[model samples]
Target: MKAAVASALRAARRVLAACHESPDGDCLGGALALCLALERAGKRVVVASTDGVPAVYRFLPAWERVTDRVEGLGSFDVAVALECADLERAGRFAPVLAACPVLVNLDHHRDNTGYGHLVWQDPQAASVCEMVYALLAELGAEVDEPVATCLMTGLLTDTGSFRYSSVRPETFELAAELVRRGARPDRIYELVYESRPPSAVRLLGLALSRLQLSADGRVAWSVVDEAMLQQAGARWEDTENIVETLRSIAGVRLALLFKVEPSRVKVSLRARDGARANEVAARFGGGGHLGAAGFVARGDLEDVVRQTLQAAAAEVQTGSG
Candidate 1:
Protein backbone atom coordinates (compact mmCIF):
# COMPACT_ATOMS: atom_id res chain seq x y z
CA MET A 1 0.00 0.00 0.00
CA LYS A 2 2.81 2.40 0.87
CA ALA A 3 4.62 1.68 -2.37
CA ALA A 4 1.46 2.17 -4.42
CA VAL A 5 0.59 5.46 -2.70
CA ALA A 6 4.16 6.71 -3.09
CA SER A 7 4.26 5.74 -6.71
CA ALA A 8 0.94 7.46 -7.34
CA LEU A 9 2.21 10.61 -5.72
CA ARG A 10 5.53 10.56 -7.53
CA ALA A 11 3.90 10.02 -10.88
CA ALA A 12 1.55 12.95 -10.51
CA ARG A 13 2.42 16.62 -10.54
CA ARG A 14 -1.02 18.22 -10.42
CA VAL A 15 -3.27 16.44 -7.91
CA LEU A 16 -6.93 16.87 -7.10
CA ALA A 17 -8.11 15.87 -3.64
CA ALA A 18 -11.64 15.62 -2.34
CA CYS A 19 -13.76 14.24 0.48
CA HIS A 20 -17.33 13.04 0.81
CA GLU A 21 -20.39 15.24 0.67
CA SER A 22 -21.57 16.86 3.88
CA PRO A 23 -18.06 16.21 5.15
CA ASP A 24 -17.53 15.82 8.87
CA GLY A 25 -14.38 16.83 10.66
CA ASP A 26 -12.51 13.68 9.74
CA CYS A 27 -13.06 14.12 6.02
CA LEU A 28 -12.41 17.83 6.03
CA GLY A 29 -9.36 17.52 8.23
CA GLY A 30 -7.86 14.71 6.22
CA ALA A 31 -8.39 16.59 2.97
CA LEU A 32 -6.85 19.75 4.36
CA ALA A 33 -3.86 17.95 5.78
CA LEU A 34 -3.19 16.06 2.55
CA CYS A 35 -3.58 19.13 0.39
CA LEU A 36 -1.16 21.08 2.54
CA ALA A 37 1.33 18.23 2.65
CA LEU A 38 1.20 17.76 -1.09
CA GLU A 39 1.63 21.46 -1.66
CA ARG A 40 4.64 21.46 0.63
CA ALA A 41 6.06 18.59 -1.43
CA GLY A 42 6.00 20.94 -4.42
CA LYS A 43 2.91 19.33 -5.96
CA ARG A 44 0.10 21.46 -7.38
CA VAL A 45 -3.12 20.45 -5.64
CA VAL A 46 -6.76 21.46 -5.59
CA VAL A 47 -8.96 20.44 -2.67
CA ALA A 48 -12.71 20.12 -2.92
CA SER A 49 -15.83 18.94 -1.16
CA THR A 50 -19.40 18.85 -2.39
CA ASP A 51 -20.59 20.79 0.63
CA GLY A 52 -17.36 22.79 0.89
CA VAL A 53 -16.05 23.82 4.30
CA PRO A 54 -18.61 24.30 7.05
CA ALA A 55 -18.40 27.44 9.16
CA VAL A 56 -17.17 25.45 12.14
CA TYR A 57 -14.25 24.08 10.12
CA ARG A 58 -13.44 27.43 8.54
CA PHE A 59 -10.88 27.97 11.29
CA LEU A 60 -8.93 24.96 10.00
CA PRO A 61 -5.72 25.88 8.26
CA ALA A 62 -6.14 26.05 4.43
CA TRP A 63 -9.88 25.51 4.72
CA GLU A 64 -10.38 28.26 2.15
CA ARG A 65 -8.76 26.07 -0.53
CA VAL A 66 -11.73 23.72 -0.59
CA THR A 67 -14.15 24.49 -3.39
CA ASP A 68 -17.59 23.12 -4.15
CA ARG A 69 -17.50 23.40 -7.92
CA VAL A 70 -15.48 21.03 -10.11
CA GLU A 71 -17.46 21.31 -13.33
CA GLY A 72 -14.75 22.97 -15.35
CA LEU A 73 -11.83 21.61 -13.36
CA GLY A 74 -8.92 20.85 -15.69
CA SER A 75 -7.38 17.43 -16.07
CA PHE A 76 -5.42 15.86 -13.26
CA ASP A 77 -3.21 12.78 -13.06
CA VAL A 78 -4.26 11.65 -9.59
CA ALA A 79 -7.23 12.25 -7.30
CA VAL A 80 -6.97 11.38 -3.63
CA ALA A 81 -10.21 10.97 -1.75
CA LEU A 82 -10.23 11.06 2.04
CA GLU A 83 -12.85 9.40 4.24
CA CYS A 84 -15.04 8.63 1.28
CA ALA A 85 -16.52 5.12 1.31
CA ASP A 86 -17.41 5.22 -2.39
CA LEU A 87 -17.19 7.56 -5.34
CA GLU A 88 -20.89 8.36 -5.19
CA ARG A 89 -20.37 9.75 -1.68
CA ALA A 90 -18.56 12.60 -3.41
CA GLY A 91 -21.97 13.55 -4.88
CA ARG A 92 -21.72 15.87 -7.87
CA PHE A 93 -17.95 15.70 -7.73
CA ALA A 94 -17.90 11.97 -8.44
CA PRO A 95 -17.74 12.50 -12.19
CA VAL A 96 -14.89 14.91 -11.79
CA LEU A 97 -13.03 12.31 -9.76
CA ALA A 98 -13.75 9.62 -12.31
CA ALA A 99 -12.04 11.64 -14.97
CA CYS A 100 -8.71 11.20 -13.25
CA PRO A 101 -6.44 8.45 -14.62
CA VAL A 102 -5.32 7.46 -11.14
CA LEU A 103 -7.43 7.51 -8.00
CA VAL A 104 -6.46 6.84 -4.38
CA ASN A 105 -9.07 6.11 -1.78
CA LEU A 106 -7.93 6.73 1.78
CA ASP A 107 -10.59 5.89 4.32
CA HIS A 108 -11.25 4.20 7.67
CA HIS A 109 -14.82 3.15 6.99
CA ARG A 110 -15.56 -0.55 7.46
CA ASP A 111 -17.57 -0.80 4.27
CA ASN A 112 -15.51 1.16 1.80
CA THR A 113 -16.32 -0.06 -1.70
CA GLY A 114 -12.64 -0.18 -2.70
CA TYR A 115 -13.46 1.69 -5.89
CA GLY A 116 -10.21 3.52 -6.44
CA HIS A 117 -7.25 2.38 -8.50
CA LEU A 118 -5.14 2.44 -5.35
CA VAL A 119 -7.21 1.81 -2.25
CA TRP A 120 -6.05 2.24 1.36
CA GLN A 121 -9.11 1.37 3.34
CA ASP A 122 -8.15 0.53 6.92
CA PRO A 123 -11.14 -0.19 9.10
CA GLN A 124 -8.93 -0.21 12.18
CA ALA A 125 -7.92 3.39 11.53
CA ALA A 126 -9.69 5.65 14.02
CA SER A 127 -9.96 8.42 11.47
CA VAL A 128 -8.86 9.14 7.91
CA CYS A 129 -6.63 11.84 9.35
CA GLU A 130 -4.70 9.15 11.19
CA MET A 131 -4.08 7.34 7.94
CA VAL A 132 -3.12 10.61 6.25
CA TYR A 133 -0.58 11.28 9.00
CA ALA A 134 0.95 7.89 8.39
CA LEU A 135 1.01 8.56 4.68
CA LEU A 136 2.67 11.93 5.19
CA ALA A 137 5.30 10.25 7.33
CA GLU A 138 5.93 7.64 4.63
CA LEU A 139 5.94 10.19 1.81
CA GLY A 140 8.46 12.31 3.69
CA ALA A 141 6.13 15.27 3.54
CA GLU A 142 6.61 18.05 6.03
CA VAL A 143 4.16 17.86 8.91
CA ASP A 144 4.19 21.55 9.60
CA GLU A 145 1.66 23.62 11.55
CA PRO A 146 -0.93 23.52 8.78
CA VAL A 147 -0.72 19.75 8.43
CA ALA A 148 -0.67 19.17 12.19
CA THR A 149 -3.60 21.43 12.94
CA CYS A 150 -5.71 19.97 10.14
CA LEU A 151 -4.95 16.36 11.03
CA MET A 152 -5.57 17.00 14.72
CA THR A 153 -9.01 18.43 14.05
CA GLY A 154 -9.99 15.13 12.43
CA LEU A 155 -8.57 13.10 15.30
CA LEU A 156 -10.32 15.18 17.94
CA THR A 157 -13.69 15.23 16.24
CA ASP A 158 -13.84 11.64 14.92
CA THR A 159 -12.83 10.25 18.30
CA GLY A 160 -15.36 12.43 20.07
CA SER A 161 -12.49 14.20 21.83
CA PHE A 162 -10.92 10.82 22.63
CA ARG A 163 -14.16 9.50 24.15
CA TYR A 164 -15.02 6.92 21.47
CA SER A 165 -14.01 3.25 21.52
CA SER A 166 -12.23 3.51 18.18
CA VAL A 167 -9.51 5.57 19.83
CA ARG A 168 -6.44 3.48 20.61
CA PRO A 169 -3.07 4.13 22.21
CA GLU A 170 -1.66 4.73 18.75
CA THR A 171 -4.32 7.34 18.15
CA PHE A 172 -3.07 9.37 21.10
CA GLU A 173 0.52 8.81 19.96
CA LEU A 174 -0.31 10.26 16.57
CA ALA A 175 -2.15 13.12 18.25
CA ALA A 176 0.87 13.87 20.41
CA GLU A 177 3.09 14.01 17.33
CA LEU A 178 0.65 16.40 15.69
CA VAL A 179 0.61 18.58 18.82
CA ARG A 180 4.37 18.65 18.83
CA ARG A 181 4.22 19.78 15.24
CA GLY A 182 2.00 22.72 16.28
CA ALA A 183 -1.56 21.52 16.77
CA ARG A 184 -3.30 23.22 19.69
CA PRO A 185 -5.93 21.12 21.46
CA ASP A 186 -7.39 24.01 23.48
CA ARG A 187 -7.92 26.18 20.41
CA ILE A 188 -9.55 23.33 18.50
CA TYR A 189 -11.86 22.58 21.42
CA GLU A 190 -12.91 26.20 21.58
CA LEU A 191 -13.55 26.39 17.83
CA VAL A 192 -15.36 23.09 17.38
CA TYR A 193 -17.25 22.50 20.62
CA GLU A 194 -17.63 25.91 22.24
CA SER A 195 -18.41 27.91 19.12
CA ARG A 196 -21.95 26.76 18.46
CA PRO A 197 -24.24 29.46 17.06
CA PRO A 198 -27.32 30.50 19.03
CA SER A 199 -29.60 29.06 16.37
CA ALA A 200 -27.92 25.69 16.75
CA VAL A 201 -28.49 25.81 20.50
CA ARG A 202 -32.16 26.54 19.91
CA LEU A 203 -32.35 23.69 17.43
CA LEU A 204 -30.94 21.37 20.05
CA GLY A 205 -33.74 22.25 22.42
CA LEU A 206 -36.36 21.62 19.75
CA ALA A 207 -34.74 18.33 18.77
CA LEU A 208 -34.56 17.14 22.35
CA SER A 209 -38.25 17.79 22.82
CA ARG A 210 -39.00 15.19 20.15
CA LEU A 211 -36.62 12.55 21.49
CA GLN A 212 -38.16 9.11 21.90
CA LEU A 213 -36.90 5.79 23.17
CA SER A 214 -37.78 2.33 22.05
CA ALA A 215 -39.77 0.06 24.32
CA ASP A 216 -36.59 -1.75 25.32
CA GLY A 217 -34.79 1.54 25.89
CA ARG A 218 -32.09 0.24 23.64
CA VAL A 219 -32.77 2.79 20.92
CA ALA A 220 -33.30 6.54 21.17
CA TRP A 221 -34.12 8.83 18.25
CA SER A 222 -35.32 12.29 17.28
CA VAL A 223 -36.50 13.74 14.00
CA VAL A 224 -35.70 17.30 12.95
CA ASP A 225 -37.93 18.41 10.10
CA GLU A 226 -37.42 21.38 7.82
CA ALA A 227 -40.01 23.35 9.71
CA MET A 228 -38.26 22.70 13.01
CA LEU A 229 -34.94 23.88 11.57
CA GLN A 230 -36.58 26.96 10.10
CA GLN A 231 -38.20 27.77 13.42
CA ALA A 232 -34.85 27.45 15.12
CA GLY A 233 -33.10 29.26 12.26
CA ALA A 234 -30.66 26.38 12.13
CA ARG A 235 -28.91 24.82 9.15
CA TRP A 236 -28.08 21.14 8.77
CA GLU A 237 -24.53 21.62 9.97
CA ASP A 238 -25.91 22.86 13.30
CA THR A 239 -27.18 19.35 14.07
CA GLU A 240 -23.68 17.89 14.12
CA ASN A 241 -23.41 17.12 17.85
CA ILE A 242 -27.10 16.53 18.55
CA VAL A 243 -26.76 12.80 17.80
CA GLU A 244 -24.24 12.54 20.60
CA THR A 245 -26.86 13.94 22.92
CA LEU A 246 -29.18 11.04 22.05
CA ARG A 247 -26.38 8.51 22.53
CA SER A 248 -25.72 9.83 26.04
CA ILE A 249 -29.14 8.88 27.37
CA ALA A 250 -29.27 6.22 30.06
CA GLY A 251 -29.93 2.64 28.85
CA VAL A 252 -29.89 3.75 25.22
CA ARG A 253 -27.47 1.53 23.34
CA LEU A 254 -28.26 3.07 19.96
CA ALA A 255 -29.06 6.65 19.08
CA LEU A 256 -30.35 8.19 15.88
CA LEU A 257 -30.87 11.72 14.64
CA PHE A 258 -33.03 12.14 11.56
CA LYS A 259 -32.85 15.37 9.59
CA VAL A 260 -35.57 15.90 7.02
CA GLU A 261 -34.29 17.39 3.78
CA PRO A 262 -36.14 18.60 0.70
CA SER A 263 -36.08 15.29 -1.20
CA ARG A 264 -34.65 12.91 1.35
CA VAL A 265 -34.16 12.20 5.03
CA LYS A 266 -30.61 12.17 6.37
CA VAL A 267 -30.07 9.79 9.25
CA SER A 268 -27.09 9.71 11.57
CA LEU A 269 -26.64 6.70 13.84
CA ARG A 270 -24.52 6.21 16.90
CA ALA A 271 -24.22 2.95 18.77
CA ARG A 272 -22.61 1.47 21.86
CA ASP A 273 -20.14 -1.40 22.18
CA GLY A 274 -22.38 -4.27 21.16
CA ALA A 275 -24.03 -2.50 18.23
CA ARG A 276 -22.76 -1.78 14.72
CA ALA A 277 -24.21 1.43 13.33
CA ASN A 278 -22.54 0.78 10.01
CA GLU A 279 -24.54 -2.38 9.50
CA VAL A 280 -27.78 -0.52 10.11
CA ALA A 281 -26.76 2.25 7.72
CA ALA A 282 -25.74 -0.24 5.04
CA ARG A 283 -29.30 -1.57 4.95
CA PHE A 284 -30.27 1.80 3.54
CA GLY A 285 -27.41 2.09 1.03
CA GLY A 286 -24.99 4.03 3.27
CA GLY A 287 -21.81 3.18 5.11
CA GLY A 288 -19.42 4.37 7.83
CA HIS A 289 -17.52 3.25 10.89
CA LEU A 290 -19.00 0.71 13.27
CA GLY A 291 -19.72 3.11 16.12
CA ALA A 292 -20.97 5.93 13.92
CA ALA A 293 -22.68 5.72 10.53
CA GLY A 294 -25.32 7.46 8.45
CA PHE A 295 -27.63 7.09 5.44
CA VAL A 296 -29.94 9.09 3.24
CA ALA A 297 -33.37 7.79 2.26
CA ARG A 298 -35.93 9.30 -0.04
CA GLY A 299 -39.45 9.32 1.35
CA ASP A 300 -41.86 11.23 3.53
CA LEU A 301 -40.22 12.28 6.77
CA GLU A 302 -42.49 10.14 8.95
CA ASP A 303 -42.09 7.11 6.74
CA VAL A 304 -38.30 7.31 6.60
CA VAL A 305 -38.15 7.74 10.35
CA ARG A 306 -40.33 4.68 10.89
CA GLN A 307 -38.27 2.57 8.52
CA THR A 308 -34.96 3.65 9.97
CA LEU A 309 -36.13 3.12 13.54
CA GLN A 310 -37.35 -0.35 12.70
CA ALA A 311 -34.04 -1.25 11.07
CA ALA A 312 -32.03 0.14 13.93
CA ALA A 313 -34.14 -1.75 16.49
CA ALA A 314 -33.73 -4.92 14.49
CA GLU A 315 -29.98 -4.47 14.35
CA VAL A 316 -29.84 -4.02 18.13
CA GLN A 317 -31.97 -7.09 18.68
CA THR A 318 -29.86 -9.12 16.27
CA GLY A 319 -26.67 -8.07 17.97
CA SER A 320 -28.06 -8.99 21.36
CA GLY A 321 -29.32 -12.36 20.18
Candidate 2:
Protein backbone atom coordinates (compact mmCIF):
# COMPACT_ATOMS: atom_id res chain seq x y z
CA MET A 1 0.00 0.00 0.00
CA LYS A 2 3.05 2.29 0.17
CA ALA A 3 2.73 2.67 -3.57
CA ALA A 4 -0.69 4.14 -2.82
CA VAL A 5 0.68 7.24 -1.06
CA ALA A 6 4.29 6.69 -2.14
CA SER A 7 4.69 7.99 -5.71
CA ALA A 8 3.01 11.23 -4.72
CA LEU A 9 4.87 12.09 -1.50
CA ARG A 10 8.23 10.68 -2.53
CA ALA A 11 8.56 13.37 -5.15
CA ALA A 12 8.13 16.17 -2.65
CA ARG A 13 9.62 17.77 0.44
CA ARG A 14 6.71 20.00 1.55
CA VAL A 15 3.07 19.23 0.83
CA LEU A 16 -0.25 21.07 0.84
CA ALA A 17 -3.56 19.26 1.24
CA ALA A 18 -7.01 20.45 0.23
CA CYS A 19 -10.57 19.25 -0.36
CA HIS A 20 -13.66 20.26 -2.30
CA GLU A 21 -15.33 23.55 -1.48
CA SER A 22 -18.23 23.54 0.99
CA PRO A 23 -16.96 20.19 2.14
CA ASP A 24 -19.04 17.42 3.64
CA GLY A 25 -17.79 14.69 5.95
CA ASP A 26 -15.76 12.79 3.36
CA CYS A 27 -13.87 15.81 2.11
CA LEU A 28 -12.96 17.18 5.54
CA GLY A 29 -12.21 13.73 6.90
CA GLY A 30 -10.01 12.84 3.95
CA ALA A 31 -8.10 16.12 4.15
CA LEU A 32 -7.44 15.87 7.90
CA ALA A 33 -6.58 12.17 7.77
CA LEU A 34 -3.94 12.72 5.13
CA CYS A 35 -2.74 15.90 6.74
CA LEU A 36 -2.13 14.12 10.04
CA ALA A 37 -0.37 11.25 8.28
CA LEU A 38 1.83 13.58 6.27
CA GLU A 39 2.69 15.72 9.28
CA ARG A 40 3.70 12.64 11.25
CA ALA A 41 5.98 11.57 8.41
CA GLY A 42 8.00 14.77 9.06
CA LYS A 43 6.64 16.57 6.05
CA ARG A 44 5.45 20.18 6.20
CA VAL A 45 1.71 19.91 5.70
CA VAL A 46 -0.83 22.64 5.14
CA VAL A 47 -4.51 21.72 4.73
CA ALA A 48 -6.81 24.45 3.55
CA SER A 49 -9.88 25.47 1.53
CA THR A 50 -12.23 28.43 0.93
CA ASP A 51 -14.20 28.20 4.15
CA GLY A 52 -13.25 27.57 7.74
CA VAL A 53 -14.07 24.07 8.91
CA PRO A 54 -17.79 23.37 9.04
CA ALA A 55 -19.33 23.92 12.50
CA VAL A 56 -20.30 20.39 13.57
CA TYR A 57 -16.91 19.08 12.41
CA ARG A 58 -15.05 21.50 14.71
CA PHE A 59 -14.78 18.54 17.02
CA LEU A 60 -11.88 17.22 14.94
CA PRO A 61 -8.38 17.77 16.28
CA ALA A 62 -7.20 19.09 12.94
CA TRP A 63 -10.24 21.23 12.24
CA GLU A 64 -8.75 24.38 13.72
CA ARG A 65 -5.57 23.92 11.69
CA VAL A 66 -7.19 24.70 8.34
CA THR A 67 -6.84 28.20 6.88
CA ASP A 68 -8.76 30.04 4.16
CA ARG A 69 -6.08 32.53 3.09
CA VAL A 70 -5.15 31.94 -0.52
CA GLU A 71 -2.89 34.77 -1.54
CA GLY A 72 0.84 35.02 -0.65
CA LEU A 73 0.96 31.57 0.85
CA GLY A 74 4.27 29.78 0.53
CA SER A 75 4.89 27.21 -2.20
CA PHE A 76 4.78 23.45 -1.62
CA ASP A 77 6.49 20.32 -2.89
CA VAL A 78 3.28 18.45 -3.64
CA ALA A 79 -0.37 19.45 -3.55
CA VAL A 80 -2.90 16.77 -2.78
CA ALA A 81 -6.54 17.32 -3.61
CA LEU A 82 -8.58 15.05 -1.36
CA GLU A 83 -12.14 14.19 -2.31
CA CYS A 84 -11.99 16.87 -4.98
CA ALA A 85 -11.62 16.80 -8.76
CA ASP A 86 -10.12 19.99 -10.17
CA LEU A 87 -8.42 23.32 -9.45
CA GLU A 88 -11.69 25.20 -9.26
CA ARG A 89 -12.93 22.48 -6.98
CA ALA A 90 -10.10 23.37 -4.60
CA GLY A 91 -11.56 26.87 -4.09
CA ARG A 92 -9.18 29.03 -2.02
CA PHE A 93 -6.27 26.65 -2.56
CA ALA A 94 -6.31 27.07 -6.32
CA PRO A 95 -3.21 29.21 -6.17
CA VAL A 96 -1.32 26.67 -4.12
CA LEU A 97 -2.41 23.93 -6.47
CA ALA A 98 -1.03 25.83 -9.42
CA ALA A 99 2.30 26.64 -7.73
CA CYS A 100 3.04 23.24 -6.25
CA PRO A 101 5.74 21.12 -7.85
CA VAL A 102 3.47 18.09 -8.13
CA LEU A 103 -0.25 17.48 -7.66
CA VAL A 104 -1.84 14.36 -6.21
CA ASN A 105 -5.50 13.58 -6.60
CA LEU A 106 -7.07 11.23 -4.07
CA ASP A 107 -10.78 10.72 -4.43
CA HIS A 108 -13.61 8.17 -4.72
CA HIS A 109 -15.47 10.09 -7.38
CA ARG A 110 -16.07 8.01 -10.51
CA ASP A 111 -16.37 11.14 -12.61
CA ASN A 112 -13.06 12.65 -11.47
CA THR A 113 -10.95 13.47 -14.52
CA GLY A 114 -7.70 12.76 -12.67
CA TYR A 115 -6.87 16.45 -12.30
CA GLY A 116 -3.36 16.04 -10.93
CA HIS A 117 0.10 14.67 -11.62
CA LEU A 118 -0.52 11.59 -9.47
CA VAL A 119 -4.07 10.27 -9.48
CA TRP A 120 -5.55 7.84 -6.98
CA GLN A 121 -9.20 7.46 -7.85
CA ASP A 122 -10.93 4.37 -6.47
CA PRO A 123 -14.66 4.47 -6.94
CA GLN A 124 -15.08 1.05 -5.30
CA ALA A 125 -13.38 2.04 -2.04
CA ALA A 126 -16.58 3.51 -0.53
CA SER A 127 -14.75 6.58 0.82
CA VAL A 128 -11.38 8.22 0.26
CA CYS A 129 -10.97 7.87 4.04
CA GLU A 130 -10.65 4.11 3.52
CA MET A 131 -7.70 4.71 1.22
CA VAL A 132 -6.22 7.10 3.78
CA TYR A 133 -6.64 4.32 6.33
CA ALA A 134 -4.49 2.09 4.18
CA LEU A 135 -1.99 4.88 3.68
CA LEU A 136 -1.56 5.32 7.45
CA ALA A 137 -1.18 1.57 7.88
CA GLU A 138 1.43 1.48 5.14
CA LEU A 139 3.23 4.48 6.65
CA GLY A 140 3.60 2.38 9.79
CA ALA A 141 2.26 5.24 11.89
CA GLU A 142 0.55 4.69 15.17
CA VAL A 143 -3.22 5.16 15.05
CA ASP A 144 -3.58 7.31 18.15
CA GLU A 145 -6.86 8.59 19.53
CA PRO A 146 -6.87 11.72 17.36
CA VAL A 147 -6.04 9.80 14.20
CA ALA A 148 -8.76 7.25 14.86
CA THR A 149 -11.29 10.00 15.56
CA CYS A 150 -10.53 11.81 12.31
CA LEU A 151 -10.68 8.61 10.29
CA MET A 152 -13.88 7.51 11.94
CA THR A 153 -15.52 10.87 11.27
CA GLY A 154 -15.04 10.37 7.55
CA LEU A 155 -16.12 6.75 7.74
CA LEU A 156 -19.27 7.51 9.69
CA THR A 157 -20.34 10.46 7.57
CA ASP A 158 -19.71 8.79 4.23
CA THR A 159 -21.51 5.64 5.32
CA GLY A 160 -24.42 7.61 6.77
CA SER A 161 -23.62 6.24 10.22
CA PHE A 162 -23.60 2.70 8.83
CA ARG A 163 -27.02 3.08 7.23
CA TYR A 164 -25.95 3.27 3.57
CA SER A 165 -25.19 0.26 1.39
CA SER A 166 -21.57 1.39 1.31
CA VAL A 167 -21.21 0.02 4.82
CA ARG A 168 -19.24 -3.17 4.36
CA PRO A 169 -18.59 -5.51 7.26
CA GLU A 170 -15.03 -4.28 7.40
CA THR A 171 -16.20 -0.67 7.57
CA PHE A 172 -18.26 -1.39 10.66
CA GLU A 173 -15.48 -3.49 12.10
CA LEU A 174 -13.07 -0.61 11.63
CA ALA A 175 -15.61 1.78 13.15
CA ALA A 176 -16.05 -0.47 16.18
CA GLU A 177 -12.32 -0.25 16.75
CA LEU A 178 -12.32 3.55 16.30
CA VAL A 179 -14.99 3.81 18.96
CA ARG A 180 -12.89 1.69 21.23
CA ARG A 181 -9.92 3.94 20.50
CA GLY A 182 -12.00 7.07 21.26
CA ALA A 183 -14.29 7.97 18.36
CA ARG A 184 -17.44 9.02 20.11
CA PRO A 185 -20.22 7.88 17.79
CA ASP A 186 -22.89 9.23 20.08
CA ARG A 187 -21.25 12.64 20.26
CA ILE A 188 -20.90 12.80 16.50
CA TYR A 189 -24.49 11.70 15.84
CA GLU A 190 -25.81 14.35 18.20
CA LEU A 191 -23.78 17.09 16.57
CA VAL A 192 -24.54 16.10 13.00
CA TYR A 193 -28.20 15.19 13.38
CA GLU A 194 -29.49 16.69 16.62
CA SER A 195 -28.30 20.24 15.97
CA ARG A 196 -30.14 22.60 13.64
CA PRO A 197 -30.23 26.39 13.56
CA PRO A 198 -33.52 28.30 13.65
CA SER A 199 -32.99 29.55 10.10
CA ALA A 200 -32.54 25.94 9.05
CA VAL A 201 -35.96 25.01 10.36
CA ARG A 202 -37.45 27.91 8.45
CA LEU A 203 -35.60 26.82 5.30
CA LEU A 204 -36.91 23.31 5.75
CA GLY A 205 -40.45 24.63 5.89
CA LEU A 206 -39.90 26.73 2.78
CA ALA A 207 -38.42 23.81 0.87
CA LEU A 208 -41.33 21.57 1.85
CA SER A 209 -43.75 24.21 0.70
CA ARG A 210 -42.04 24.35 -2.67
CA LEU A 211 -41.52 20.60 -3.14
CA GLN A 212 -42.13 19.64 -6.77
CA LEU A 213 -43.31 16.22 -7.79
CA SER A 214 -42.46 14.76 -11.14
CA ALA A 215 -44.41 12.16 -13.13
CA ASP A 216 -45.73 9.40 -10.84
CA GLY A 217 -44.23 11.21 -7.83
CA ARG A 218 -40.95 9.33 -8.30
CA VAL A 219 -38.89 12.55 -8.27
CA ALA A 220 -39.31 15.42 -5.82
CA TRP A 221 -37.54 18.78 -6.00
CA SER A 222 -37.37 22.13 -4.30
CA VAL A 223 -35.15 25.10 -5.05
CA VAL A 224 -34.32 28.14 -2.96
CA ASP A 225 -32.53 31.09 -4.49
CA GLU A 226 -30.64 33.97 -2.93
CA ALA A 227 -33.91 35.82 -2.63
CA MET A 228 -35.38 33.08 -0.47
CA LEU A 229 -32.26 32.87 1.63
CA GLN A 230 -32.25 36.61 2.18
CA GLN A 231 -35.92 36.57 3.09
CA ALA A 232 -35.49 33.67 5.50
CA GLY A 233 -32.18 34.94 6.95
CA ALA A 234 -30.74 31.55 6.00
CA ARG A 235 -27.28 30.41 5.00
CA TRP A 236 -26.00 27.48 2.99
CA GLU A 237 -25.51 25.37 6.06
CA ASP A 238 -29.18 25.79 6.86
CA THR A 239 -30.20 24.17 3.58
CA GLU A 240 -28.15 21.02 3.88
CA ASN A 241 -30.68 19.03 5.88
CA ILE A 242 -33.70 20.33 4.01
CA VAL A 243 -32.85 18.24 0.93
CA GLU A 244 -33.05 14.99 2.87
CA THR A 245 -36.67 15.71 3.77
CA LEU A 246 -37.75 15.76 0.13
CA ARG A 247 -35.88 12.51 -0.42
CA SER A 248 -37.72 10.85 2.46
CA ILE A 249 -41.21 11.53 1.22
CA ALA A 250 -43.27 8.39 0.76
CA GLY A 251 -42.99 6.89 -2.75
CA VAL A 252 -40.61 9.60 -3.93
CA ARG A 253 -37.60 7.79 -5.33
CA LEU A 254 -35.50 10.90 -6.02
CA ALA A 255 -35.08 14.27 -4.35
CA LEU A 256 -33.10 17.25 -5.60
CA LEU A 257 -32.89 20.40 -3.50
CA PHE A 258 -30.98 23.11 -5.27
CA LYS A 259 -29.74 26.32 -3.69
CA VAL A 260 -29.46 28.95 -6.35
CA GLU A 261 -26.42 31.05 -5.61
CA PRO A 262 -25.34 34.25 -7.27
CA SER A 263 -22.59 32.61 -9.30
CA ARG A 264 -23.44 28.93 -9.21
CA VAL A 265 -26.30 26.60 -8.38
CA LYS A 266 -25.54 24.20 -5.54
CA VAL A 267 -27.30 20.91 -6.18
CA SER A 268 -27.91 18.03 -3.81
CA LEU A 269 -29.36 14.74 -5.01
CA ARG A 270 -30.73 12.00 -2.82
CA ALA A 271 -32.50 8.79 -3.74
CA ARG A 272 -34.46 5.88 -2.40
CA ASP A 273 -35.68 2.51 -3.68
CA GLY A 274 -32.51 1.93 -5.74
CA ALA A 275 -32.43 5.09 -7.83
CA ARG A 276 -28.90 6.11 -8.90
CA ALA A 277 -28.44 9.75 -7.86
CA ASN A 278 -24.71 9.32 -8.38
CA GLU A 279 -25.25 8.39 -12.00
CA VAL A 280 -27.29 11.53 -12.54
CA ALA A 281 -24.74 13.72 -10.76
CA ALA A 282 -21.94 12.19 -12.80
CA ARG A 283 -23.68 13.25 -16.02
CA PHE A 284 -23.31 16.85 -14.86
CA GLY A 285 -19.69 16.57 -13.61
CA GLY A 286 -20.37 15.57 -9.99
CA GLY A 287 -19.38 12.53 -7.98
CA GLY A 288 -20.84 10.63 -5.05
CA HIS A 289 -22.61 7.41 -4.06
CA LEU A 290 -25.68 5.94 -5.76
CA GLY A 291 -27.95 7.22 -3.00
CA ALA A 292 -26.44 10.70 -2.53
CA ALA A 293 -24.69 12.95 -5.01
CA GLY A 294 -24.37 16.61 -5.95
CA PHE A 295 -22.86 19.15 -8.34
CA VAL A 296 -22.56 22.88 -9.03
CA ALA A 297 -24.37 24.18 -12.07
CA ARG A 298 -23.16 27.62 -13.13
CA GLY A 299 -26.00 29.33 -14.97
CA ASP A 300 -29.40 30.83 -14.52
CA LEU A 301 -31.25 28.90 -11.82
CA GLU A 302 -34.24 28.10 -13.99
CA ASP A 303 -32.18 26.64 -16.81
CA VAL A 304 -29.98 24.62 -14.51
CA VAL A 305 -32.89 23.28 -12.51
CA ARG A 306 -34.82 22.28 -15.62
CA GLN A 307 -31.79 20.57 -17.16
CA THR A 308 -31.00 18.72 -13.92
CA LEU A 309 -34.59 17.59 -13.47
CA GLN A 310 -34.66 16.32 -17.04
CA ALA A 311 -31.45 14.42 -16.47
CA ALA A 312 -32.73 12.97 -13.21
CA ALA A 313 -35.90 11.88 -14.94
CA ALA A 314 -33.96 10.25 -17.74
CA GLU A 315 -31.71 8.42 -15.30
CA VAL A 316 -34.67 7.10 -13.29
CA GLN A 317 -36.51 6.06 -16.42
CA THR A 318 -33.42 4.38 -17.82
CA GLY A 319 -32.68 2.55 -14.60
CA SER A 320 -36.27 1.56 -13.90
CA GLY A 321 -36.84 0.20 -17.39
Off by over 4 Å in 2: 1-4, 7-12, 209-214, 221-233, 256-269, 274-318
Best by TM-score: 1
Tens digit per residue, CA lDDT, model 1, 35-54: 88888888888888998887
Indicate which candidate wins on lDDT: 1
- TM-score for candidate 1: 0.83
lDDT of each: 0.87, 0.80
lDDT of 2 at 187: 79
- Model 1: CA > 4 A from native: 209-216, 222-231, 235-237, 256-269, 276-318
Question: Candidate 2 on 65-125: residue-level lDDT in tens?
Answer: 8888876568898888887767788886876787776877888778787777778887766
lDDT of 2 at 69: 85
Which window of 10 residues has the lowest lDDT sum in candidate 2? 1-10
